[model samples]
Target: MTAPRTLLDKLWAAHEILRREDGVSLLWVDRHLVHEGSHHGFAKLAARGLKVAEPDLTFAVVDHYAPTRDRAHITDPQIARMIDTLRTNAKAQGLRIYDLTDPEQGIVHVIGPEQGLTLPGLLVNCGDSHTSTHGAFGALAFGIGATEVAHVLATQTVWQRKPRAMRITVEGTLAPGVSAKDIALGWIAALGTDGAQGHAVEYAGSAIRGLSMEGRMTLCNLSIEGGARFGMIAPDQTTFEYLENRPNAPKGAAWEQACADWAALTSDPDATFEREVKFDARDIAPTVTWGTSPEQALPITARIPDPDTVTPAKADAARAALDYMGLTAGQALEGTPIDQVFIGSCTNGRIEDLRAAAAVLKGRKARVPGLISPGSAQVKAQAEAEGLDQIFTQAGLEWAASGCSMCVGMNGDLVGEGMRCASSTNRNFRGRQGRGARTHLMSPAMVAAAAVTGALTDVRPLMNGRAA
Candidate 1:
């Protein structure tokens, strides 16, 4: 009798061409996502006089350096050059490129699944760290370095070292006001940042299954924050429904066959994992990060940790984070002032995330300057069609076009030095949003609540009552 195989094992076996004695294997890549930064890879290819092995399987987008506020003009000379270079490279390689003005343009991670370019039981790679976001669809997706990118572009395959498998199961139902962002923050807090190091984490159990495809993307998006290179969930009805009418999704008979194949992609019941962890969904609360690290998260109602109370190994880092954030240990996180509120990123820039923020901002004005950027042009159009943009603008928040925006400081949008921002984007590391900027990471609703209140406010109460 054969032993049960894990989803990771199955995926690895399916694409693996040869396993070397040095623990490296050549694996076929199903999708290659490229961004402006990928110009380096293209330059390498040019230097070597090489052409893309499979241009049809590669996709490009202008996200990192694209301006979210101005669609007509990109003012930064360096950024404009990078965008132009990417366009030139894509054209030369005959790869599909979503230019800045393309209706399909958006953050690479956000557009992949939305367009159905990401699918179950496939291998996806990108030049950006959040490429694991595609893994939400049950794909074996992860980020690769510039050199690796050139190799994939040249041969449509990657030399990889297989990672150990870990399963994180969340049971029970989430309480009201709690979101996928909160669940992710709570998990990072409980397990610490490096808990999943060298592992591919598969999120499972009732609570994870209950989340929508967007929510699952938010969960998997932060896999890197937990020090995991890959994260995934088994494809199910929710996954299929989301991909049904997408632009690149299978059609007619192919759709039916795809569904059948996806249905069989789940891990066997008796499959064993290298590591396993469990959490009760009911125990999680609306969470927010208090320090530079995502793992420094706590419930909105809880106080910041006193650095001295942390273990010796973590105490120094905790102190450093508090000092950098200008936060005092043991202080209440609620009511902490924020200079800005940003509600978008690959992590929480989906239409559902916009709806949640809009729900909180409706009929109320923001107490602080706020910006809202949709995940893609389609998502932006959808939000406008649904009047979500009106709701945000009515609440005194700037409705911006789709791009990475303030999530990374590369683009024109940024929080000034020493300014505090309540952000929905992942990664609260110091200077992640801007130089000398302090970021508090939360869900879209929480960011909306903070915008309305000018502080880090719990979204649960605001959900029950109109914003004041």
Candidate 2:
């Protein structure tokens, strides 16, 4: 008789090549994703005179510094150099790359699942922290540092200290206008940033299962913001349907068998986790971040929290955040002025997110300047085909190419200093968008609502009489 094992246990055991005396495990790398920032790893490999151990298993992308505008005429020499470096490295290493010229090029996290490179029961690694986005497909995915990246490039294996397993179950259905982004914010707000530290969180129950593949990706993408090692959900019909016919997914008989195997990847009924948390979906609201951290979020109808109201350990940080954000405590969060809006990122830049924003922006006009970049070129084309791009432009927003854009502040699509932006991107950390910039993280629809009202208006009111 075997004991009930969690999804993490199964994934860890399957990929683990060996366990060291120090409790460190050597894991077989299934997919290694690299971007422009990975130049450090490539440089390390070059200095060591080693080639990528398994070029076919590695993939390079030009994202971090990818220009959202005028790719053919990138003026920033530094940005151009970074993008070219990844291209040269990938070509020299014989690894596949999705460069700016490639139609499939997009954010690493977005394209991985878009092309079906992410799958159930696989371990994925990337130099970017948002690598957990792939875990939405039930893969064990997490970010790696420059040294770890080099190690993987040299051996196609990585050393890791196994993280404990935690399960967060959200029961019941979400109210209209509420979304996965809200659920993520709600949990982080309740638990604070370090709530799931050193734990690989598996989201379960009705609400999680009901989320679309894109929603699941958004939810998992923000796991790191809450100090989670990674986040995952059991692959089911929705997962299989999303992966069906993807470019890199298994074909025909292989696909059928793959789904069957993935179906068994769920945690057993009797599986026990190191820690468990539960949330009633109905209690979550359309949420937004007021402070610098993702956990400093609250319901749309709430007021900015007073520093004194925060825990003694966090009160000073809360005060500092308020000062940096130029916000006052005890003020209503709704109707707070915003200088601009951004509606894209790996966190909320998929086709579905665009559709949600478009549904809100349609037949309306934005009161402030904004940029809307698609997650990938494929998503860009899909948005154009569906006239979502037209809706954005008609609503007074710039329709830009696919890339990290303002979300990362590396590609020059940045928010002005002291500017307040309602963004769909994950992470509201000070200077995340740009130095001296103030960011309020929310869902795409909520960003669209802010763009229209030029304030932090609850999307629910704007969504009234509109399809959710």
Candidate 3:
């Protein structure tokens, strides 16, 4: 019998476009999700008198720099022009678009699976780093540069080398106060910034199976932070269950057939891996990043690492992060002051995240500045109807319309120089939130705790040192 292979290998093999005699493999893209960033790619193609060769497989959205605070006319000429350009380009190419005005419009990664546009065995690409979020739905997704975006748009294909597989088997159950965010942070912390370098991670084992779709998305969203191209979980009954009755999902018989196909997509039991890691979920704490990189994280209950103990290279990274963040080693991660608390992004802006934050802020008030933006207009309305907006406002948080807000500084929401922010967004890289901004990435509830407490305290204490 032939040796077993992972779902990634199986899908890539199935979608193989052609093999280069030199050993590189070409991959057929099943979905090409684009954003305002890739409009330039379309322009480049049009400049050469080329059209989107596969309009049916391409999708465009305008969320990255879309204004969320006012939703009024985009006064910034550059942003307005960019938005118009995308609309024109999508129309010109006959590609489907979830326009800003469309009820379905949202972060590309969020709307894609919500609309059943992302599916198992598909090779997906976007021009944004978090495209890995789609992998939670059992697809092989990765981000591409503008040049590569143009190539994919021109041919519905692109060259890709196979990534080595790493099976990260998380066992047992997560302890109290632990979340997928914590798990992701824990792994990144353990592996440093490059633990999963040049590899595709398959997060498996009992603990992962128990995570909700939102949790899975959170885990996969930060795969790149761990130096991984992406991470994935096979589409199982849980996946089918999430999509079976969605408005855009296949109906009845079609869904059954789709489920059957997805069932065949998992890695075989005997599959081999280039590397494997194991972790006990209980060992993970409510983690928070102390410095610029996600890997510069420590459990909230733990103290920051001493720079002296690390190797020279690690010491340099630690020093750079500290200098940029203005922090000293060996300090408690829990009591640092926060200037702002932001809860909204493709990573944690979903309705579930809102509920989690609302739960923590129910009768509490944020002593510091706070903001909450839902992932989509639909989520906004749902949250408003539930009076979640009231909870946030009563807790001293600004209830705003949905868009990338604070998740990316392009929307004009920024954390000023020397101001530390407790955020639920993914990246905490240098100047990620804004120029000279210091961001400590955590979960929604954790952000709420920071908002109320005005300090980097362990959220486990609020939830009674347990996962809520």
Candidate 4:
């Protein structure tokens, strides 16, 4: 008889239709989500005359290239064509599509949880790298490439190999000025760029347990940055409470059954993981990205690293990033000038993120160019009705419509070459924003502080009267 199994193992066992020794297993996919950018796979399917196997299990959305400003018709001809193509493709394939005009429409990652489409113990897949965001619900979620996307659509299953597990535990309590974003940045910083390669990470400990649902989303959103295929938190009371009364959440008798099952989804005390790392949460400060990679970061209180002091293996990349960012060694990050500030993306584009930014920008004006795009239309409407958009615009930040704006270059929005931007979006790769455009990833509140000061300013000081 086997002892209690990890959540991943339990899900895999339940979904395993057939297992071939050393061969691909015929597993079932519970949910398959795709967005407008997934047209690449649709086109491939069309060329092959293959149809989507199960429309019930597949959901498509429009976000990546959807027009933000003019919703009437996508203003950009190329983008408009893409939007029309998705509608046509999904319709012809008989798949459920949450289109631009759908009340449920939003960034794929944001829309899934909002509608309660993402559930615990499910196997989820999407064409975008950020699909791992669903793992916040304790689902075995991760991204699939264009080919894999087509295959999943053609048959309700994806062939995949299991990955090793890494348990990351953060004990102690977070300081007042710190946030989930800071913890995420700190993990990436300590892990470097490829620390969790070929591994799925499970986060535990008191600090993670204390994080809100949105914070858990933020933590899992950057799992890819930590070099993990995905990250998850075992379903706890907080997770159960958040999903309890949600729109499509299981109800009445179903709810009780779900809670019972979810209660059994945690890792056993004797469960073994491939590797484990622990951190003292109190030791982490507000974190910020300085160089190209997400791992290339330092605390807001620390100075930029000198190339000479960097490890030999990392020196070349560090030098290259420094040259591209035009930063001098040992310079304090506090006073670096910023040309723009962006507060949006799947990472931190929800209502909570907006409120945090607005708190710092209230009654203040931005000295640098700035923009804030909520993750979805519902969030946008709520922010406006609550007058949060007014606070941002009054403070000189542009209030834009929803879509994945500026985070991915597929949209026309972008930063000018060589400009430095304090952004809330994830991924600070060299060409992430645009060629030669420098990115400094920080919390939404900190990004607002940078906008107000027109530099990489610290929010801890600005929250009061001083500027750190």
lDDT of each: 0.92, 0.94, 0.85, 0.85
- Alpha-carbon runs more than 4 Å astray in model 2: none
Model 3 TM-score?
0.97
Better of 1 and 2 by lDDT: 2
Window of ten residues with lowest summed lDDT in model 3: 459-468
List residue ranges in candidate 4 displaced over 4 A.
465-468
Residue 450, candidate 1: alpha-carbon lDDT? 97
TM-score of each: 0.98, 0.99, 0.97, 0.96
User: Candidate 2: how many backbone clashes?
Assistant: 0
Instruction: Please provide, for model 1 over 214-242, each residue's C-alpha lDDT reduced to its tens digit, 9 standing for 90 to 100.
Output: 99999999999999999999999999999
Candidate RMSDs in Å, in order, are: 1.4, 0.7, 1.6, 2.0
Taking the tens digit of each residue's C-alpha lDDT, what string does model 4 give over 1-468? 688666667766777888778856777898999888888888888889989988888888888886667688656889888888888988987878878777767788887887777888888899987787888888888898999998898888888777787888999898766778888889888887688888888888999999887888888888888888788888889888878877777899998998898788788887888889999999988788989999998888788998889889898888988999999889998889999999988999888888888888889999998878789888888899889999999998899877888888666778889999999989898878887789999989889889999999878877775221
Instruction: Give the better candidate number (1 or 3) by lDDT.
Output: 1
Lowest summed lDDT window (length 10), candidate 2: 459-468
Which one wins by lDDT: 1 or 4? 1
Put down candidate 3 lDDT per residue, 265-296, tens digits, no spaces.
88899999999999998898888999888888
lDDT of 2 at 436: 95
Backbone clashes for every candidate come to 0, 0, 6, 0
